[model samples]
Target: MRLRKPKKEWRHRKQRRVRITAMIRKELDWIVHDKISMFILFFLPIFLIISVGNVEFNIDSRAQDTVVYVIDLDSSEYSLDYIETIRGENFTFTVYDNHENPDLVTMENAEALIPTTELGAYLIIPSNFSETLLENQTAKIDLYIDGINTIEMLVIKYQFISANLLYQVEYQVFNSEVLYIPEYRPEIDRSILENAVPNMIPTILYAVSNMVACQAIVADDPLKRMLLSPTRKGEVIQAKTFAYIFFGALLSLVCMCVLTFGFGIYFISPLDTFLIFWMTTIFGVTFGLFFSSLASSRLQGAQLFLFSFIFQQMLVNNLRIEPIVNYMPIEVIRQNITDIVYRGIPFLSLGNQIALIAGMNLVALGAAWLSLSLKKEVA
Candidate 1:
């Protein structure tokens, strides 16, 4: 009787394994056939890497003509010489005399001009600038910059500082006296693409995984019929989750390789970075599955995914409430990516982040399982 019971149990276990494998294969087939899914999973990352990496944001001779507005309050020879010395082929300077346009330096005028005109930056040479400098004292030049584009702002600021340094050197040579100018130069060693691509990895993985997985159960019309044939909802959900996660890992690998080999963006710990990306994919898939289970139709699932994505992005990027933002899932992922990729922090050092992500994944997976289990029919 014991031997017969063991044989029956073994047969049941084999049958379950076959069922799971079949379900996983079915899910993979669906992804391969779906045009949108294929693009998001395989092609989107490559496209983004190529398009974003090729952009040039360096402050060099290749800089496009930048229009700078100057309100020269000190119309002295020294100020004029300073202006001329700072001029570059890439800069088109428009000098406004204080007597001609006294209101140009006003806060209201600056606010209006910077936004409305093609003004890259507005400079004000103080009336006492020449007097102070002649007296062997440091003079301050008030610079109001249009900070809409960060790269452009940095470039403009760099050009101004470089020119000012040259002017100071000329002054020292002409007077044969030591004149001190307090310098403020920010260290910008990496290009824009180098800094941006690392931050983008987690976001891209999360977004694509979430987007594709949101339609997993809701869009599969055969799921309802399958459930009637000894296939439990939990098994179905598990199969779909496994399949999506497998593909998500592959997508993450492809993205990292493209950015590293194709674009020369290096990761300090490639293995650790890839692990974090894979974890992000797991979180994204489970989160989407929870929503997909809640949704009644494919359209509703898509809407939920879009709304969730936008809301998360706004919170992570724009929200200033630090206490709340710190615990948010996307924000945590972003911070960890920065730590691992940019700061070279080890993956195990981010214990809190990894734990939170794991906890969130479990909660999402549990919620999805419950939702699917309770549903009368999954359509």
Candidate 2:
């Protein structure tokens, strides 16, 4: 009886192993049959690596025309030399003599010029600049940069610093005198972490939610079987979407807590910030679902989501078009988040941004529903 029982156990174990092996084989076959998915899954990383590796990072190669307004209070030969040193092929310096136009020395005048002339920065050379440099002391220069675009501000700053370094080197060689030009950005008060974290939160949340939800419907093999029953297609999609949204809300909360406690970042209005985060997650999920419904396989869905995300990021950030940048999904979320978190602007004031996000969500959700309704088998 013991020997017969051992044989029965062995047979059961063998059958279970066979069933698992068959399932694995079936999945392999499915993957092999889907050539497009296989290609994307295998070659996409290599393609991305090669493409990114070929990008140019040299700032000099991509230098754009920058206009700087110089407020020269010194009116000395040394000050003129300093200005000439900083000016390059790409940099156009508009020198404003503080003596001729006493009003130009005021911060109000500088601020006014930025809007009207689209000025990049203001270089204020102190009256005692030449005297201090001649006495072998470090002279300070006030650099009031247009802080609206961080990238442009940085480029202008680095270019100035680089040119200043060359001037110092040349002066030391000729006169054996020490010179210094310390940059001061009065416009920007916040630290790099404070300025960057708020902008990054929405983007990170959107990316994670989109990636996870992209495979929600199209990759779900059991969804087809479920649809065979009395379960409505809308119910399945709704349940899946709601499940992801709940998970996304929890994720958003965790991210907020980490930003607040772990990173010591404070939100002006926690409730409004949380609401925005939740809304961003919903949009991400819906956007992913729109792509997932359009795609035939999990890999295809993921690829579609990736392409869309990359395209929008490039369009919004690099495209100099005002209308497109204002209306892009990522840009809208980022701008509103920046306003609420950093500027302390109330959520109610951002009705336009909220409405645009809501409208986009509706369009995406409708498209996903339509796609699913039109096609019987999603997978």
Candidate 3:
């Protein structure tokens, strides 16, 4: 019997023939078939830009402004002193004379002209107000706060009352003593401000890394092929993971550019800013790849993505498993990645940023290697 021609046996090899280009084409095709999904993907960055633009964050602890209408039934020095005690830019005051029409502050006017339409709330100082104020008796001050500005109005009112009481005695001795307030020190709070981006970076990186860091086998089928030529499992994993990291890094760079030139993320050196953003990107994408490897299907991968995304959202409110989620690498896995927009970057100073990124990549690559199946399901 004639011997049958031996079937082709494959050996692993690397052909630097732009292997990634083939994959990119496949990804593009996937995008094409689903126009709606592709359209959404194209606009993802802009949507997030507008979405994040509306968000606000604060760190300083201080009182806010409030408006008060003082019905001065007592014009005595004591009553005046009581009013003077509450004297501060934090509160806006309008002293209504007893002879003046109460209509301006009447139930009718209060309903029509109070805080809802004005600066916030109004307080009434009844007749003999100064005599009782000096007597150390509980003198009543009726207040009407616009319910529309309820939270803001309440905060202002509480501060106004508390401050007025504290300084009431002080005014008795020093009529015009100006209290000194220390200026805010950015240098002292550099660490806190610098590390704030970690809260957002983890989640942001996760979404972008998926564009490149998907682990899968490439097979050659005439109708559908992910292979340009013979591609090894190890090579495929390496290329994909590296590309994923690159995508995150690119996204971070893009955001950094917009924040600096477009939205003004910071007021510092371009080099320094770039370094900080780069470090943040590394932490995010590396964590994303790690999560990707653990998943069994695209659905599982998306589930992982949602978990990271939610975790990032929680970080803005300081609600998460870790108190330091704001600065974690995993946070980049969400679209919520931050880049020292309001503060500085910590754990990723110049050299440390580089080291951390390199370290993370190493960890991700190692994980991918361990999980890659030479005898994969597709081949």
Candidate 4:
């Protein structure tokens, strides 16, 4: 039995170019000739594999634990018991002089301590709290949380609320009374937990856009590349995008791993997370290509990439549907992408974000093809 010679037909050629993951991996393997490692090879050498301390989820790492200053005006057995139980993950209880008399809490005092000391959360165990809790009357507690610190502090706040409720439940239980645990989790429709997947497909579209490929396909020095004609402009563009998809995926994977294991954020489904990350990455690549295509010089591409970094860091801040949309030149960027008005999980409805991202990709790809076509012809 013998194999036939290559057909070299158009159909065969189309079938042959069906970019495979294994091939992409192999191409990346060749990127760092000797080192052939995954993320380190694609982006930079793994400089700090050994972090000074534990890795963090969000960019700014929190302290080992958040300290809760309990001005317990009551200091009752029940309150004291509750305080002891708070030592686990989110809350570390530090008793101030006045935890027993929460009624005496001044408005100014509450404002100063809760926000200034970087506290995770603050709570008042009212004088009426114990009696109302025991007399089968509904009790209310006031908590002040720091809103500036996004997910990490938010997680601690949720935990504190849960722990507080648990203390109430135990209060009723010991007093031979019954109280229903209030079950309100804001429906979590698209809260931070679900957001672990992705707010929008920024990373996915970023990979597809393939900006890293720009570096790989450039003719080294522009003057030298003008002397060659063996490669088509289209082929060069394709190869560069391929390289970006490879690199972007690597950076994103590291980010997800750090968020998951290093931080306690749970992913309901890895597949969903992967999709969201890859899509957003493709978005980044698309923006990169758009920059590369338009710039007269490669240095311009680097400058534009920096500009994009600034814009993307603030994407969700400025670009979102909200109750009150107001932003100054810098106020626009104070928030972040996740904070943007992505009402709920994206793509659940399957049109707007996907379309928006795809539209962006079309603009990028079109520009890339057009400009590269002209440059190739000129060469």
The candidate scoring highest on lDDT is 1
For model 2, residues 1-379, the per-residue Cα lDDT tens digits are: 3544345442465654544444445444554565553454334423432333333333433335555667888889888888777764434344454455676545667768775435667778999999988886778998887777777777777778777778778666235544655676555555444666556667667876787678777887866875674455555556556666665676677767766665467787888888888888888888988888888998898899889888877887777488878887778888778878766788778888788888998898888888998986767
lDDT agreement with native, every candidate: 0.79, 0.69, 0.50, 0.50
Candidate 2: lDDT over CA atoms?
0.69
lDDT of 4 by residue, 47-75 (tens): 22213112334323353355555555456
TM-score of 1: 0.68
lDDT by residue (tens digit), candidate 1, 1-379: 4554345442486778888889999999989999999898778877877767776533353335555666787889888877777664434345444445676654456657787546667778889988988876778999987788777777778778877777878655235455575554555466566877656767788888998899998999988888877677888888999999999889889988988898887788988888888888898899999989999999999998999999888888887477878877777877778778866788888888789878889899999999988988788
Scanning candidate 3 in windows of ten residues, the lowest lDDT window is: 215-224
Question: Compared to the true structure, candidate 4 yields what TM-score?
Answer: 0.49
Q: Per-residue CA lDDT of candidate 3, range 161-216, in tens?
A: 66565665565433344545567765444333234344443334445444223322
Better of 2 and 3 by lDDT: 2
CA shift at 190, candidate 1, in angstroms? 1.3
RMSD of each: 7.4, 15.6, 7.6, 11.0
**Which lDDT value does model 4 have at 318?**
60
Candidate 4 worst ten-residue window by lDDT = 327-336
* lDDT accuracy of residue 21 in candidate 2: 48
Best by TM-score: 1
